[model samples]
Every structure is written in C-alpha cells, then in structure tokens.
Target chain A: MADIPIRIGIIGCADIARKVSRAIQLAPNATLSAVASRSIDKAANFAKANGFPPEAKIYGSYESLLDDPDIDAVYLPLPTSLHHKWAVLTAQKKKHLLMEKPLALNVAQFDEILKACEENGVQIMDGTMWVHHPRTYKMKEFLNDKERFGLLKSVNSCFTFFADPDFLKNDIRVKPDLDALGALGDAGWYGIRSVLWAADYEMPKTVTAMQGPVLNEAGVILACGASLYWEDGKVATFHCSFLSNLTMNLTAIGTFGTLHLTDFIIPYQEHEASYTTSSKPQFNELVTGWVPIPSEHTVTVNLPQEACMVREFASLVENIKKNGAQPDKKWPTISRKTQLVLDAVKASIEKGFEAVEIVS
Target chain B: MADIPIRIGIIGCADIARKVSRAIQLAPNATLSAVASRSIDKAANFAKANGFPPEAKIYGSYESLLDDPDIDAVYLPLPTSLHHKWAVLTAQKKKHLLMEKPLALNVAQFDEILKACEENGVQIMDGTMWVHHPRTYKMKEFLNDKERFGLLKSVNSCFTFFADPDFLKNDIRVKPDLDALGALGDAGWYGIRSVLWAADYEMPKTVTAMQGPVLNEAGVILACGASLYWEDGKVATFHCSFLSNLTMNLTAIGTFGTLHLTDFIIPYQEHEASYTTSSKPQFNELVTGWVPIPSEHTVTVNLPQEACMVREFASLVENIKKNGAQPDKKWPTISRKTQLVLDAVKASIEKGFEAVEIVS
Candidate 1:
C-alpha cells in the first residue's frame, strides 16, 4: 500500500462511535474523515466533541456520508437492527465496512451484507476490538503451540453488566425494535466471539441454550447462556446478561494447558493487557495446593486495541486502493462463523433448548 | 460434657487419607487415635508415614478399628462403591463419620448410610474440604452482604486435571465397581459443590447435562458438564474432567457484584487463598476501559481447610458425646442437596442430555 492514509468515515453517532472515532484518529493509517447522524447538529456536535479535524465532513444523513467519494471505509456503529440496511448501502457505495456486532440480526442478513461487500470488492470487518489487541495474538500463540497448550478441550466465556433501571427500559439493547436480539446480540456477541476465537474459529457441531433464560416483557432477552459442542468433543459455554455486575471472563482448557483472562471483551487498561497460562499443571504431592502455579503474561500495547482494529481495517482498505490487493478473508470468515454459532444458540433457545446443529 | 478431644480413627490407605490423617492430627479437638487397612503392613506403614502419635493404634483389618470402643469417630476415605458398606458400618458402630465425597454409589445407598446414622445417633459429614476454608467463609460473608453483592444471578465452576494414561487405565475412579461415577463423582463433586455454595445450597429446579460428554468404553464419564436451573431464574453451569490440564475456577455473579477465583478447590498455597470481587463496576466515559477494577481479597489460613473440616466434625461429635446434643442438621442437609443435584445431572446424561427435574 502507498503512504496515503485511509479516509475513514463513521456512520451513526452512537455512544460507541465516540470511542471508535478516537481510535480512527489514533490509527496511523486511518483518518476520521466524517461523521453522520439523522440531525446535522448532532453530527456536527459529535465531530467537534470527538476531536474530528476542522476539514472533516459532517453529514445530516447516512446517505450523504456514503456519497462522499473520498471516504475509504465506513465504520457503522448503528444499532444492530440497522446493520443489514446501512452496511449493504455502505458496501454498495464501494466503501470498506467496519460494522459493530451482532453483525446483523442473524446470519441471513449478515450473508447479504457480505455479498454486497464482495460484489463491490470492498473489505468488511466487525467492530470486535479485543481480538485486535496484541495480548490476543500472544494468547493465540500459546493456544496454537502444541507442546505448550496441546489440543483444546473446553472453553467458557462470560460478558455481563448490570443495567440500571433506565437502561432496562430505554437502552437500544433492551428495546425490541431497535436491537431486538437484546443481551444476546449485545454482550452475548462478545462471549460467543471469545469462544470461537479460542477454538481457532471452528464452529461447534451443536449449540444448545441453557435452561432458565430470563426474558423481558417485550420478549427481549435479559439473561441467557448456551453450551457449544464440537464433533471432536471439544466444548464451549458462554453466559451473557444485562442483569449482573460487569464481568468479562474467558477461559480455555486444553489437554496440557489452560488460558485464562478476566477482562477478555475489554481489557482493564488500554495500554496493556494480561492473561494467565498453565502448561501441564499438577497438584502438590499432598494434593494440598498447585505444584507449578500458573504464570501471568502481559503484553504491551503501542496502539490501543480499538486503534489497532481501525489501523488493520484501514490497512486493508489501503491495500485495495493503492496495490489493488484483495481484502483479507480471515476477518469476514470469522465474523460469519461467530454469527452462525450465535444463530444456532438463538435457534436452540427458540426450540426450547434443543440441540441445534451448525449446518455450515 | 467432658473436655476430651474426639478420638478419630482412619480407615483405608487411599492417598487422600494421608492428607486427612494429617488433618486429623492438626485439628485441635480431634485425636488421630487409630489407623486400619486390609493389611497390617499398609496400616502400620501409613500410620508411621502420616505422623501418627506413638500410642496410636494400628490394626490389620477395618473391623478391628471399628471394634475399638475408644475411637469416637471414623474418617473413611474408601472409594465410592465401598462408601455404602463402610459408611453404614461406621454409623452402626455408633461412631461419628467423616467420609470422602460421592458419599455413596447413589442417593439410595446414601440414604441407607443415613438411616444407620440416625438409628445409631451418630453424626455424619462428607469430606468437602474447601467449604471449611477460611477463604470460603469470607466469600460467604461477601455473598451474604446484600448491599455489596445483591441477589445471586448465576454461577459457573470448573475443576479438571490431566490424568496420565496409567490413571485412566488403573485409577479406582475409572473402575466401574469402585468409584463408578468417575470424573463426575471425583472432580465434578467440587464443581457442583462450588455452585451450590454460591447459591447458598438452594437446589436447582432442573439439571441438564451439557452435550459431548466424553466417556470410556466401560460407560464411565471422563469429562462432562451440566447446567442447573433454579426456580428463581438463577442458573449455574459446571464442568469437570480427567482429560484436561488442572484448572479450578469458580465465579458467581450477582446483580451488583461478582466473585471470582481460579483455585477454588484448593488454593495455590496452603497458607492463603484469594478471590476477586467487583461491586457496581462501570465503564469509563469513552467505554474504552473499566472505571474501577475489581479488588482481590485474601484470607490467611491458621489451619489448613482439611484440618478445619476435621475440627468441625470432631466438635460435632464432642457435642453428641459430652453434651448429649443431637447432630447438626445443616451439614447433612447440604450434603444431601449436593448429592441430589449430582443425581439429577447423572440422570440428565443418562436421558440423552434431557433436563431432569430435581424432585426435591
């Protein structure tokens, strides 16, 4: 790719877009070129407050932002329900897509968005920031090391936050129409993604929702969990809720090793993140305690995870723009696999907790 | 009502009994008075190696130990299949009982042992050592604090250890006629107990075994997991295995707080244990990181948890012997509840991962 920085425009001034906007500016290869909202004042205020450069465009409508030819990519932070409509539009405009997760309401919608991106020869990636963290790459190294971690056996991940009364009633996540999947699409996306990441993006053979899911009056999920089973007997379980104290924990156990991190969705700090690893752990001779204790590994972050995400996405856009290179298939493939497993879980829940096969 | 220490006799030469023997010696109110085995050589050798006092009795047969009128209680570390026979014998002998877990082959046998205890007016307790840990009590204190932790929502616990080929082939836990429950009874006991502890011993309404449980040719489970659902929408998931690296993790999340610990079964060190807790955690303004990180709380052990267990059991025996007091119902009630949940999980697995209702 040439030295030209990727011009990144963000559609939707959702609260999350504020962080991604800063991430875009911090990304060396990406520039925050514009922001769009239904109201021009809201878009203008978001640009000024989020420190968009004076020359950065402010569009009153998403279509106006998409019409901007100079924009190399679009970061869509709209509610999940709108992902299919706006993501396809953004891709149709020949712009790369970086969209927030529960990528679409379900896999069918995600497939449509994917087809649009493919047809337009545009790159697409979900706004899953943690996977871009250096720590995640380091953990992946451990997981893939046969001598260290061995074959994966099981994994568990959880992402939950206690939603206040106002959020329960008014947040887009809890509203049936806006983000209809509710906690499953919101926090559960991270949990499912974390498990898939640990399994090296392998979709499970079966996904079965755990019994006793809590649903709100509007038929939006408040709390839920599911277990995923692989054909090789590897298993994963995840819990996500909007009715618990904030927790983000991911653990993967293998034949010879285990990987654990408490802040998996978002690290406790932006500058660095830590994970614990134990290879061939054993109990003390007396069975009173651990023999060789697990060791904590910390990775330094030069660019925060979100910034790394933007830089990676923009780098892909730059590759296509300057070198006429193809977009990396890894990101979109993983996104689809995560969505597929999530869709299976949702289906299992709808089918009264029956085991739902992952056809793909 | 005399101030005499409870005289405890050790039965069987299992490896776990070595630790429990030491615990009996350490308990201030418990005297390690006797050791017995199928052979005198093993009994004498075990007694000497485990630091039995010079005057402690050594017998060739368990019946000899049971015949000793001076022995006030028996610590039985026999395998699961032997639990019914030995536990009933100990109770029939009017000796207070502290038996290793999977208290019997099943609930029916456990009830038989309990009947013997009731008839003999003897106290009985399962050897679930972690619950006696001072760290556990401190964690309970936090859980009971409604202001800090609020209502219980969900819990997840895992306990696994990588067993060598020799263990898979020869360990009593894998033998159908011995510890028939295999990993479910061995490690899964702790996982289930941990969840029950987090839920304050409230039995779940149903138990559904997770899919892809790995079993040996003899139909013994080597690895399995289950999700438990409570009447109040509370849920818990547990995984246990003999095919993964050693990992013990217990996490309980509430509406306002969370408690997490990696070494819940046994601490990394015998002298101390730690748990992490977060109360009302929130994201920072940009949602890039947490506002306040969770805090780690550590509890020092004056006596190892096993010794604490021995001390508690011996104290109950003292009340029965000296004060003529009836046995404490709390320990038996919880043990029964844990066993009931385990039974439901086992039934769920037998019924092809169906959700089995907890009759009680």
Candidate 2:
C-alpha cells in the first residue's frame, strides 16, 4: 500500500509473458525480478531484453524459478497442458499464483490446485484479465440497474477463430494432454466466464452441450455450445469455435430490453454496445415519422500502459501486503466453479448432449 | 391452377376470424362464403360487416357450419382447448381444414387429428403464418447460401407480450383445458415452431426445458425455455414469457456470420436486418468488404390480413382441389413433427427440466 514494489518471477518467456513483463515494470508497486523458461537462452534473452535488475535471477526451469526466495509471486503462462502442474507447485511453494485463462483441464485438477492453495496459505487466481478490465465491470454495473433492463432473461455469447495449421502442431490448444479442453477452454472460456460473472456467479441449475469433433485430428473438439439455466428461469447460451473465422459477441436480454457488446473477448480501443427496448412501441405508433431506435454506443477506454495481467497480479500483491491474503482468497472458489462447469460441458458432449447439472 | 375462387367458411367470429375474413376478400381466388359463431346474431353480424353475400349461410354453431356442403374449406381459430375438436370434426366432415397453431394439446391429439384427416381424405394444415411470410422465406434463402453464412450453429427466438387482464380472464392461453398445455402451448408454440422451421424440421435429438409456474393460477406455466440439440451438433434455444411486458426478437448464428431479426412475431414495417462476420478472416472476406456485408435489408410484405389462417386455408383448398383431398401433405408432416417437439417441451417442464428425446 505504501508504494513498495512487489517482487515477481516470470514462469515462461512466451509472447503473453513478455507483455506482462513490461507491465510489471510499469506498475507503481511491482517489479519483474526474474525470468524462467525451458530454454536457458530464451530466459536469458528475456532477462536481458527487459533490463532485469542486478538482483533479478534467471532460471532454466519453472521449479528452480519458484524456489527463488526473492521472487514474491509467480506468473504462469505455460502451455495449457502444464497449467495445473505448475499452478499447484507454485502454491505449494507458498508463492501467490496467477495462471492463464483455464485453471485446469477438468474440475478435479482445479480442485487439487484449490486444495494446494488452501493448505499452503497462498493465493491462486485464474488470469482472466478481462474480468479485471473496467469495461466488463461497467457492463456488470449496467446489469444491476433493474429499472433499465428489468429481470435478466437470457445471455448469448460467441467466441470463435480459425487456428493456423502450423500453430496447431505443438500448440496446447490442439494437444490431448489438456484432456478435452480446447476452444471451450481457450477461447470459449471468456464468453462463459462473462456470462457466469454477469449472473453473479450463480451456478447454472442445468446444462446441455454439443460439440463438433475434429475429423482431421483425433480427440479434438472444434466447436462447442452450451445452454445453462438458473433456478429463477434465467438462461445462458454460449458458443465457442476454433475452426471458424474470428468473432466475439455477447448479448444480454432482459424482460424490458436487450443489451449487446460487439466485441466481448478482446479489449477494444473503442468498444461499441447497444440497448433496445422490447416493444419499440413509440417507433411503431409513429410509423410515418418513425426513426430507427438508435441502439448503439461506442466508448473509448484509456487502458493503463501495464498489461491487464500485470496490473491484476500487482493488485493481488498489494492486497496481500495490506490485508494478508484476504483479498486474494475468493478466487479459488470462482476458479473451481468454472472448472466444474467446463467438466459438465465435456460430460454433455461425451453423452450425446445429455443435460448435466452442476453440483456446486 | 386456374383463377378459380375457393369458397371458404369461417367457423368462429373470434378476432382471428375477422382477420382471415379480410384476407379472403383480398386474395384473388378466395371467397368468404359463410360465417359461424356460437350465437346466430354474431354470425350474421360478422357476415354483414365483412361484406359476405347476403345469401351466404350464417350458422349459429360450428357443427352447422361444417355441415354446409357449399363451403369448400373451413378456417378454425378457436382456442387451444378447441383446436383438436374442430380439426378432427372438420376432417370428418370432408372439409379441408386450417387450424390455428399448437395443432393440438399433445402428440396423441395431433396423431388423432392426422388419422382423422387420413380416414376422411381431407387436407389439414397448422396455421403457422410466420413461415409463410416472405421474410421467413428470405431468411431461408440466406441460410441456404453456404458461401454467405456457412454452417448453421444456433437459433435463438423470443415471443412475449403483456396480455390484458380481460383477455387473460377466460382465455385458453392463460387457462387451457389440459393443465400440461399452458404458455408452452400458447406463445411458446410459435417460438418452438420457428426453431423447427429454421432447422429444416430436423427434430432435436434431445430437449431440456424449464418453466415458471403462474403464481395465482394452479397448473399454469407462464415463462418457459428449452434447449434443443441436433445430431450434427447444431443447437437451438427458445424462450417465451407471459407475465413480461411485450417483446419479441430472434437471432440465428452460423459458422461465418449471424442474422438478426428484431421482432420475431410481428416485425415493424421499417424493420431491417444485417449480417456481419466475426472480426476474424471470414471465408467471404473479399465479398464482405466490397459491399459492407449488407448489415440490414428491408423486405416489403403486406402483412396478410388474417396471416396464418388465410395461408393455411388457401394452401389446403389448393391441395384438395388439385388431388381431390388435402393430398397426403408435407405440411401436415411438418406440423406433426412440431407438435412432437412441443410435447417434449411440456414433458421436460413437467419433469423439472429433465432431458426428453424426440422419438420418431
């Protein structure tokens, strides 16, 4: 809280890690004190490129990086297959952890990480940076004003993109070690998490899912859809696809009206949204003089120079320093619940879209 | 095929009958030959007001109207409680039948109606007017063009409105004879039928549904939702609400892009629709940038005066005149399939959103 920079270690020198590394240096109370990767050259290159301080340690392996006492926290940008292992190990080392989008391949693995964090008295957070973004928080604020939209009725979200064949060879997105987690986990997770968060983390009472299996590759699910329901009759429908051209859209419908976000997954320099009432009654009655319901709004956000990941990690470190881990304690529960929903999606796919209930 | 007029009898003086009567006058080859209601005065008043020939028979009851041999076809706009009764009776009377939607309360009733029409050599059709609209046909055109939108992914539809308390008092929509058929039969039928029609009548392999029970009315379901799955991994979702204020919107998403129609039930005269590819490299990127991908298009259609009933009756009459009966029809088969889906929706609601498979 007093502007003391929190020491941080980088677990991988991937593209995302570089961006986060730069962000750490820019944050007021955070320092990127170390770098690690499977390749020594890659780690040393990243440390030199970022101008790591003299005290900054360079390690050839993630385990050795976590062993550094000077590194107060860890940022895990490992491949999808390695997230759970390193996340649990980082927690066991008593280092606060921030792992990428999906916390694990399945609910069981996520629970293990949660248990590790609990036993070690360390914090674990899924690096869902979008949730920490102000625009998403703004959308949540708009949803809370019942007078504006009435009872939330439904949410529909889509996140899709085409994957390059070359990138597909060794990419964790196409690898089987991740265990049935691909588009739904990589791209679809943002859409799913947005819906769940918009609904105040209320677990869907029922879920039905369908996925297109990859014909060219074995054990690859390319496109997936799921419909989740709440006890109060609210429904959320989501679609994630890796074989399609790029697209990201989210729509929330309520009894009174509907709201749409043109780009949900990516942080747009200028984001656009629209809201329309159910009836368009006045427009109908004034047919001769009718003007289209001006239903769109575009907002420009001045994002901080820091990467969303670095900002979130720095925030967590500051929270730990101020409140001694209480602020970072709620994330494991959220991450575990998300993994459970993902597991339900997989079960539904395996059983021919049989409706699966999230047991909480 | 010639310009020969078909004589039609109206078997009810309800609001729907008024609309149909007007459509018949506007149709080049359809004649309003008779009018009927529970009260002779009401029948006579409707005939006179609608400019039916002075000699046109005015029957006090539907039975008498069906007995009129001069009436080549009968349009039935009775409540859901009466649809099966009148449909079967019309078929038994050897009259081509046009029945309003939900076809019947359940699959068994629909089967009975189909059997009755088969035995009597009569044509039967559900008055599902939405599919008959030119806009719907245009939507189908867009869907069939693979280069434009690619594979169908999902269909979302909503049909909801605030009903006058007076209309809800004794109306079959609010209080159907069979307790199982509530809003799921009334407005929900349209939403379900839309999905079925859009999906090319490929009955979902499985369906899961949930409904909100009417607070003051026992055995009445108000709001309902259902998630449907197709064998090819396509998903469809439908939502209907009775207590909510008026609103209707439908959207269909595909692999390449999305098609959005604001008012699913009754679109405004100036209604426009647009298609946009998600911000990735769309398969049709070259084509999209050249023309702005046509965000929206306004289609001109003279909303058929009595849209559903008129279309159904005209189609049945044409079929009967061509083949001496309502030719063992494709329309009837489609209607039967929709009824089965609707029945599954009801079953799922009754079982607390349990999955229901659509048996052939």
Candidate 3:
C-alpha cells in the first residue's frame, strides 16, 4: 500500500536545516511542504539554495508556517533556547514535531515540551539521526547476542569538533542566550545518546563530572566529560568538545566481547558504515598478542541516516493519522532520559565535580 | 658489535616467569642462565619446560640464585610483597635487575629498592613488555609528528580481564601476603603505563579515582579507575579490572589527530599489530560521514615484545659492563613516575575517592 507523503515544514533555517531539508526530500514518505525564517527573503533564498522543491512554500516567519494547514509536521532547527517555545507551538498546532537535539536547555523544559505533544496528540522525536542508520540495528544484534557480546559492562562515546575563532565568536551555539549549554548540549547530545542507546536506555544511578572542564568567558562548557555509573555495575563515560579536531569515537565492552569504531556517530562514507568486534578476545601465549583477532563488520547504508530519521518519523505520523494509534512513546521516552542524564552531568559539574545522584 | 649474551637468572617460578624465561632465551643479547624456586624439582621442571639452555643451573632457593657469580642480571617476576626484598638483594649481589611491575607495593618501598640499585651501580628496569614492541614505536611516530598529531590533548587507556572464581580465591594476586595490590598492580599497571607513555612520561598533577571501585573481601582492589590531570591541561584516564573480558584499548587525542588501538597492551597477532589514526579528520558537506576516513597502520613484529624487553635490558647491562658506563637513568626515571602515579591512584581510593595531588 502506498501511503500519502507526510507534508513537512521547516520551522527555522539554521545551517543544519539545509541538510534536514535534503533529508525531507530524500525520505520517501516525507514531503518538503514549507520553509520558514525570520526574513521571508532569507527563507526563500534558503529554499532555492538547498534545492527545496518549487512547490515548497516559503514563509516570512515560523509563526506563518505553524499556522499553515497544509503542513503535517514541523522540523525545528532553531537554537536550543527557542526549542521550548516553538516545540510547544508546533504540538499545539496539531503538527508532529521532529526537532534538533538538546531538546531543551533542561529536563523541566523538555518535560513541558513532551507534555504539550501528549496533550495535542502529536508525535515527538529528537533529530538524533544516527540511531536510525541500518548500521545501528546491525550493531544492536551483536550487543544482544549473549554468546558474542554477553552482558553489558561499559561504554565510551566521544564527539568533538574543532571550531574556528569565527564560529566561537559568531555561531549561535557559543552565545550564552542562544545555545547556553554549549558543547554539553550540542556535541555532547550525541555522546550521551549513544551511551544511553548502548545501555538500552537504562538510566545511570549517578554522574560524576571529570576534572578540568574548559569554559568560555560566559561560563559555557567548551569541553567537558562525565562518568556514569549504573546499579548493575555498568559504567559509561563521554567527552564532548568544541576545541579539538573533529572526531567521533564509540566503544562498548561486554563480559565476553568488545565493540569499537572511530566514527560511530557518523560513517566515513554516506553509503557504508563499519565497526570492529572482538568476541572472547585474549592474548596469545606470552601475552605478546591476541588470539582471536577482532573482526570488522560493515553495513550498507541504504539511505542517508538523516533521511532514515525523516522516513521513520513520517511513518510514525502516518500510522497515527491512519490507524488512530497513540503517539509512539519510545522516542519521547529516550529523549527525556538523555536529557535527564545531561542535567545530572551539568549538576555534577556545578557541584565542584561531585557525583550527582540521578533519581530517574 | 658481536657482543656475548648477558647471563640472566629467574627468581621464583611464577606463571609470568615462564613467559619471561622464554624471552630471555629468545633475545639475541640475553641468555637464560638459571631458574630458582622453593623446590629444586620445580626449578628444574620450569627450566626444562621453558627450553632453558642445557648448562642452565637450577636452585632450590632464591638465595642460591643470587649467589651465583656467573649471573649478570636477574629477571624477577615475584609477588608484589617480594619486590623490595628480592630487588634490593639482587642489586646488592652486583647483578642488573629487571623486575615485574608495581615496582613495589608503594613508592617508598620502590625508592628503597631504587636506592639499593643506585648504590650498587646496577641497571634496573620494569618488565613492561608492551613498550618494547615495535608497534608502540610506530604509534609514537604518529603522535610525535607535528603536522599529523599536533600537541597532545588527552589519553584514555583501559585494560581488563575476566578471572574465574577459582582464580579469584586461589591466585596469588588475591592473596594479601602475596600480590596484595591485586588487579590494581597486575592489570592497572599496564593502563597507567600506557597513559604515561602517551604523555611522554609527564607526571600528572592530580589523580582522582572513579567511583564504585570493586574491592575483594581482603581489601584488595578487584576493579578500579582514575583520571590524571596534568598542569598543561592534558588529561588522562585509565580503567583496569579483573571482572571483565580480556580487553586492551588505548586512545590518544591531540590537537590535530587521534590514535586508537584495541590491543595496545598486547597485539592481536604476535607477528603484526595495527592501529587507527585520524589526522585532521572532518565531516562531509552534510555531516553524513567523515571527509577522510581514519586509516589503519600495521607494523610487523620481527621479535616477540617480551624478547625485545629482555634484549634491551641485557644491552643496557652490557653497556655498563663493557663500556664501564653508568647505568641508564631513563628506565628507572620512567618506572618511578609510573609508580608515583599508581601510588596517587591508590591514595585517592583510600581517601574515599578524593582527588590526590602528586608532587613532582
């Protein structure tokens, strides 16, 4: 059965929106319905420059797009400070919401956004695209295998990128009033999400910030890390930065096996992704080397990860529109948990790097 | 120079000694001269099992091996409690010393042992075989390359192995009177050493132990970790455990590059080793993947890493013997710094996981 493509409208024309606009067009079930910015010409220019379809409407402001009856879903790529305000508006407008990460500056704001979506009966999901990659599903198979990966033990997820002086001075991410959480909310969202994804969304018992966290003049974290400990003895750590060379590394170790990849958050190529797994790895006699070497596993990327995210969101919206099913709780639940841990990390850092207990 | 092989004697026929005995024999400038244990039969069997030369002597006690005037050096793989005693005795006997790690239970005892070696003018080195591997040198090349690696930023080293119940109860490592430090001394040694090696032997200003460290009923650490903070903003972390599957992972990130290896303490195959390097890696236009994928570098292992350690130790001994040169200070200096950091970690744990400062 061929379902009608869900009409998608861009709520803000951030640089990331260009990629998401492309993803919207690439997603078979998603249609690029509208583009919106504070300036009508800027929105039209963005649409033309990003290859938005000719029929895609260009609105002078986000308020105009929100009021459009033709739009079924809104993709919000505004600064994190604006997420609470716009996400609630999108939900209240009866439009499904697919928003950029760091869903809000804090968990309370995130819960308020989720509450709006629930009351309006609208699907809500954070735009953490990599989780939708086919490679993620393939890696999950290995993690679920008792013989190969065994019980979960630890995880290390790192996401960092070198930001030039110009970005530090002008990018909305570094502005105190825009993306106030700074690296913790921007790059660290992926690291925290990756850790939660690896742990199967089991929230940690506590988070302890690492020492020597760097801060900009406005007290925004430029680089920071935290260690998360679970009741089951599984520990995880993540480091995010805006002052280092671009790097994405993820490692998950189980009782019987280990998984490693240099670019887990994003594949080196859009068409393919790879990871290494070592099952029951042991050093050979004399401990000079390993016995059963780790094997590399590559998964074909059927579609760009962002496109997969759009397709998945649109499919969920379609199910709700056609079957009268309740909005999927999985995505919102994951987004909330990631936000909770992020809050705990910030609290720990504020408390002089003490271990902050995570009640949830 | 076609120098004669330095005669080496093994004190205590521990399991590790079996590996080192073979290394002594395999080294071009090192010969296995003797074996010693509480029982002459045990020593004889160990010598025969390790393929010691036909002329290799067997001693029923360590005292007898120490008295052997023909022996130029002693490879001590004894328990942690025995290090200070045997190392001082071996040095006093006018023989060079190659002792197993955790140089001593604490820095004070380690210094006492060092003093004995210095007074006797005997060369000393810890038997951390991985550093002698050719792969380590190759990895250092990438790290030291100004264009490729830039200045160091951070390092993380993890070494873990699953120990069966019987081993946990019966192994010398678990015994208070034997290898009392347990996993911290055994596995954590490699982790700490790797972190120090990556930092080029710069001692950290502070060490903070991670929370939830597991300790056996005997009050010995079974699993633990610590973060090291340097004065120059370079940070390092290490985790070691006896409750996880065998794993050796090391990651070093610099301003412009990153290096990753799954088996840094030991290679996956004895004949060769490989590591991944990401030099100035960046994302593609849409951030779907990396611009340049991290490349894998492999180095052939011409000699077993352990043999390389033995050869290097013997050559230093030969230099002191033939050239009448003073014993090299480099090895002992590095060993002291590693022990200092280890002591700080232990102190942090003992102080209820508080940050312990390291003075020099």
Each candidate's chain B TM-score? 0.99, 0.88, 0.98
What are the root-mean-square deviations of the candidates from the true structure over C-alphas?
Answer: 1.0, 5.6, 1.3
Q: How close is candidate 1 to the true structure, as a TM-score?
A: 0.99
lDDT of 3 by residue, A224-299 (tens): 9999999988988898888877778888988898888778777889989888898887666666567788899989
lDDT, candidate 3, at A100: 93
Give the 10-residue window scoring lowest on summed lDDT in candidate 2 chain A: A282-291
For residues B207-242, could you state the per-residue lDDT of candidate 1 as single tens digits?
999978888989899999999988999989999999
Residues B1-360 of candidate 3 have per-residue lDDT tens digits of 567889999999888898888788789998999989999999999988999989999999999999999999999989999999999999999999999997899889999999999999999999998999998999999999989898888888899888889989999888889888888898999999999999999888999998888889998888999999989888888889888878788989888989888888777787888888988887777777776888888898778898999999999999999999999999999999988888899999999889999976
lDDT of 3: 0.90
Candidate 3 chain A weakest ten by summed lDDT: A282-291
Scored by DockQ, the top model is 1
Categorize the docking of model 1.
high
Give every collision pair in model 1: B1-B322
Error of 2 at B323 (Å): 9.8
Interface RMSD of 3: 1.4
* Reference-based lDDT, residue A190, model 1: 93
Answer with 1 or 3, whichever has the higher lDDT: 1
For model 3 chain B, give the 10-residue run with minimal summed lDDT: B282-291
